[model samples]
Target: MSQLRLWGHWPLFLFLSGWCAVAIFLDYLYAGIPGRKYFLLLSGLSALLLGLSFPPFGFTPLIFFGFVPLFYIQEIADRNKTSELFYVYNAFVLWNIFDTYWVANAALLPGIVAIWLNSFFMLVPWIGAQWVGRKIPSLRWWSFASFWVVFEWIHHNWEISWPWLTLGNAWSSLTSWIQWYEYTGVFGGTLWTLIMNILFFQFILNLKKQLSIRKNSRTITLILCFLIFPVLISILIDRNFLAEGKYGEICVVQPNYEPHYEKFAVPEMEQITRLGRLAEINLTKDTRFILFPETCIGDIGGPVNSARVQDDNRIITFYDFIESHFNIPIVMGLTTIKFLRDGELDSPFKRTNQAFKEPYEIANSAVILKNRLEKNIPVYNKSRLVPGAEIFPYRRLLPFLSPLVDKLGGTVAGLATQKERTVFEAGNLVIAPVICYESIYGNYMRGYIKNGAQAIFIMTNDGWWDDTPGYKQHMAFSKLRAIEFRKPVIRSANTGISCFIDARGNLGKSLGYNVHSSINQGVTFSPYLSFYAKFGDLLAYLALLFATFFVILRLFRYFF
Candidate 1:
């Protein structure tokens, strides 16, 4: 009986032994492969750590050392004369895919291409760093840091601008710890992350070389001090930051219109009726301004020119409804166009008809109005467009490729944008109507504040991504704007999370996601300009200057 039982379990024992042998053999194989397994592992680790630093996971502290694995790979590749570009690209692709995969929830192919394209742009800085490192090994780290910051700054200013993964945004959720953004903007946080990661990477390299324990201990102390001091300064500043003077009473309504399902398909009057009901419910005697989300009026487009806009039926009916219900100021987002005659369309952004008809320019814009208006209202067209979706990347420079770009679902002729920022007046208060996607930009916000905009009224349609962290992250990023500019924020999302954020980046009376509701809140505005608002990304400018200086120095050394 004992012999029979032993035979019965022999198969299980053999299976377990075979699995262990394969595992051991794989480890041996990895050991034999120079930098292959380690590079792949480092890439995976870097992606996971960086992904966790953003929203949903929001392990904000991980960002401080998230680049360690990639930096380590770069250093080793530099020393070995191996191809670092391949490994860098792999790491960046993984990071972009993991961090922004939610973008595929709307359009699958576009999202995949976006990830790859974003990864390609990320490689530009790494390539420069590698070349500089080969030329000046001692100053490689400094060059790399400067190059990364310069890349980030350039990323924000370009036509294909997608600054979603900008390193400083990691601290957005931790508002209390970055109150000093009023001075440095988000670029300061980016600088801090890079410095810490470099120091940590160097410490590890020193350890591998069998450095003294005392010296390593000093490095550890230095790294901790560098990390902790910023938080301490931010806290001190946050404690002292204050706001005074009431701007006015504002009523923000979230109509909960589903963008894909019913927002466009519903009858125009029905959409207005729903919005009117929400406004009626929330409208108070003290309400001075009523705010609505972007594109709330449904499938309506007209000339952005004030004289022609007044003649459009959509604008006429909207004004009629507002005047009948309330006699206060109103702000909303809409689609508008500008007609161009035969020779009037000068820019490539203006589209012409194939039948030799006239051309016109379309735009996504926000407008402000009151009950007793005679002239055209102040309309601000959205400038910071969503790449691929809202605007074709470099359409003007490569107009011949417009057909291919259109097939890929990008706008062939992008929305027309104004060269300057516009501010709308509500009695004594000036309101900046920041549309969807524009709110994420820090320097852009400062432009409005500098133009005498007292308070920010962000009108957005968050239903595009539903109730995921996509919308939540967007709402949280607005806090950075509030802190940087010292302006009260009144955000009205088409599908809820409508709320009020004070100058200190504090959330107050927020509606739940996907809910149809409105909130009546008292907003205060300050004419006070924060340091960031006055100077406008001075840190980014300094980083760009440093990067230029280093590049010139490398070129000069190579030639002379």
Candidate 2:
């Protein structure tokens, strides 16, 4: 009963208090740490402030100053020769706890790992920056900026890749405020944020020293430009943008199937029947396409050949409905598998005892079914899989740990993915079929656009995270994709908040969370590709380059 009271709606309170106590105890060695308790308080408060800026709260502008407190602590640590890693790591852990505590709603153990592991990854750059700065104090700011940008880059590209807290993602809710994403991508936002924080850190330092306004005039001007310039650019872009291109209307179905009790538990035929009814309500004469959320196709044994996929009663039901009722195409998520030959490219962790006669199971795919064509339906397997839930990271390297990893999350073995991005050709409209979580990757999404996807259709199942910011933030990030590529986006989620967003990131039509509904909405297609769509994460690459240069230069100087 006592334990129940402590955890009831206030588990975070208990966790935070414990976290602070642990931090205080660990800082005993640095007891003479300048800014002592104030530094610790600043760290904790800044984490809280920054965490609140993301998703649900969406106080985006606060992110600009989020790191100021830490930078202050860093400055003091540097001058006093005190270790800052312990404090920095704790601050990041607090940030992760606040921003992604909803992860616990999915699974408790993995959620704890995600929060702590992500905090550790975030701590990497700070440690590197401090180490480098100790040698070249004059170049400390540049070192800090470079380390952070490089960390964000590494997080996005590596295995166990969870870039959820990449600083730029803070503006996800404020799509209109980040129109310049077309030019630099989210890494541009990262660069902009670090620059602002550094400028403000300098401003605060100057203020402490009673420096005259004239003495710090240049830094002040820079701070003003850093704050004002991005928003100004975004506003100008938002004002002038036009979505004049024409496209067929799309109908998105939200089956509102509860993952915990209804989705997998319910009969496939019944789920399909209900989905058809939802589509029927929303289907219009102008509707050229209808989309269903991920894994709504239920489960199938192994991969059915394209020619025979419609032979399956479950898939045939939807195919027949489209043939008998409307000329429009339907796309949906499926759990599918494919057979591989003895010498074929199999999963890296394939069993040696398994016969070639036996087929391997693959999951998480999207398929397109249109007018009664004899040809096979085009299917694209999801590539950007969730770390623990979908793909066990570095399975080939750590095959022995599969059981341990799977028990912590969802899968023992990861799903297989196609090497190239697949674009579904539906008559005049070519669609990019993006699965859930795949939508978060801008560079990966650009491949579909580059392959001639006029517009994107994202199918997701957000039911696992419940009605938390997980779903809302997922939806908000889709808006950023729309702005970055200047293309209309059609999103269909398993349970709710399914929406149609225009090229300029404006909402067209949407269904609320937990609502069972569908909507037919017009979407414009653009042949126009933004700089980001063409160049892809150039800012991140440049930042990496800068970091490499600094590291090499510092090493040379240190040895000499």
Candidate 3:
């Protein structure tokens, strides 16, 4: 009887013992550290506040002060002569989990790797700032700001890039306050965020030390000026800004196929026919172009040959439908394979077929097709691929990891990409054909405008992470691009959120998630480029130079 009773209460006993073990471990971890509770509290608070500041939760005002708690945690570490790694890593991991937990809905293993790896990368700048502060305390805050911008800039340019959490992106939805993005781009918002956080942190320190009223008031005044001045300037600019140019009507179709199940499993013609039906419902005689979502072609069948894409049965049907009814151009996304002949230019991304011994490369590409008479078709291969899903970063250095990369949804040799941003001309309209993952790159998009793109058209499939903030956040990020380039944006998604964004970052006629729909809207195209489009990320470049100088100075001091 006694043994039966003890076994019956095993669950309670296990819970009690596990809780005690965690408590003891935490106590040991912070043994010599003072204000242990405060440190832990600030870490959790930092993660919570920052995570809440992102989309789906969207507490935008909280972002201005979110990093204050992290700064406090750093101070505690410095004062106690303790390593801040564990605390900072925990905070970052928690923030990543809270904001991007939806990423696991696509793939379990790759999602975990993305979250953990991104967290580690985020820690680099913080740790570097800490080290620089120890070497030269007077330049501490400057180093922190400059190092962070440099990190974000590197993240945009590198192969292992993931700029989804860039601090400037926090204002993606609040475009009214960031109209200055046309002049400064998203990096300006990042600098604004960092400066505000630093000022608020200094005010907090003054309060802690019971500083004089005059000093506290001065800091408070500076914070208010920094916060209010930007908004006022942005308001004035938005009120005065006008989108001037030729107006053209475009039809965007959202054929809501479930990516994991219906998109690939269904036949190619069936999907094309559905897209045709949606386009027919919304397309008018004045419609200049019809846009389809990414990978709408070549999902059921294998990738079509780039040289003979028009020969595919699905393409024949789509082209016939457009030529018969509308006689207009259609820009759509597809996968294409290109074979290389002997003595041709070579690339490391090439793959060899075991059966025929032929060299070829596969690309996630967007192509614009007109009537059969049009011989030259324009195709732009996506250059910015998702790190694990579409590419294996540093493949030349780590050939041993090719098998692992293959398992993570990438090809063994990685996908091929084009060198230049291609613009497609349909009648009098010239637009940039931006693929799924390319819209988030502000600086990269500038190349299209410089190459004579008047408007931006993005084709994407956001259904992989179904019914999550991933799709919403992706849609929100496009607004930043529209503001930066001062160009109208037309987006077509496979599952939902297809709409038109104006030059001022305003949405017009949006379709919701999981809805099969289409929208016909007239958008104005600007011939003139914005300041940011003309000069790309100047602030980030300056920050990189400053960060490099600081590091060189620190090294000289250490050696001397």
Tens-digit lDDT track for model 2 on 1-560? 01111122243554567777788787765676565656778888789778987886889878878888888888777677666677778889999888776666666677777889999988888777766776787777788798898898888877798888888888877777788988888888888888888888889999999999999898899998888888999999889887766578889999987775567766787888889999999787888899999988645233444335667667777778997666778889887766556686556433222544555656688988875554667778899987887778887788897786777765665677888999998776888999998998888899999998889899998776666677888888888888888889899998747999988777789998889889998878777888998999888878888888878878977998
In the range 224-307, model 1's lDDT, one tens digit per residue, is: 899899889988987777787665788888888777666776677677777778888878767889998897652533234533
Q: RMSD in angstroms, candidate 1?
A: 9.0
Q: How far is 282's C-alpha from truth in model 2 (Å)?
A: 1.4
Worst 10 residues of 3 by lDDT: 1-10
Clashing residue pairs in candidate 2, if any? Answer: 303-337
Higher-scoring candidate on lDDT, 2 or 3: 3
Off by over 4 Å in 3: 1-28, 354-357, 556-560
Report lDDT (CA) for all predictions: 0.78, 0.80, 0.83
Candidate 1, 328: how far from true, in Å?
1.9
> Model 2, poorest ten-residue lDDT window?
1-10
lDDT of 3 by residue, 1-560 (tens): 01111122232244335533654477577877775666656776888888888776778778888889988877877787777676677677667766676676676667667777888998898878877888886677778899999899999999889888898988986889999999888899898989998999999999999999886998999999999999999999999998898998999999998777678877888888888888998888989899998988775688878878778877788778987777978999998888877765377678887754678888899999888765566778999898878888998887898877877878766788878899998786889999989999999999899998899999998877767778888988899999999999999999758999999999898899879989999998778799999999999999989999889878887888
lDDT of 2: 0.80
Give the candidates in order of lDDT, highest first: 3, 2, 1
Instruction: Report per-prediction Cα RMSD to one decimal.
Output: 9.0, 3.4, 6.3
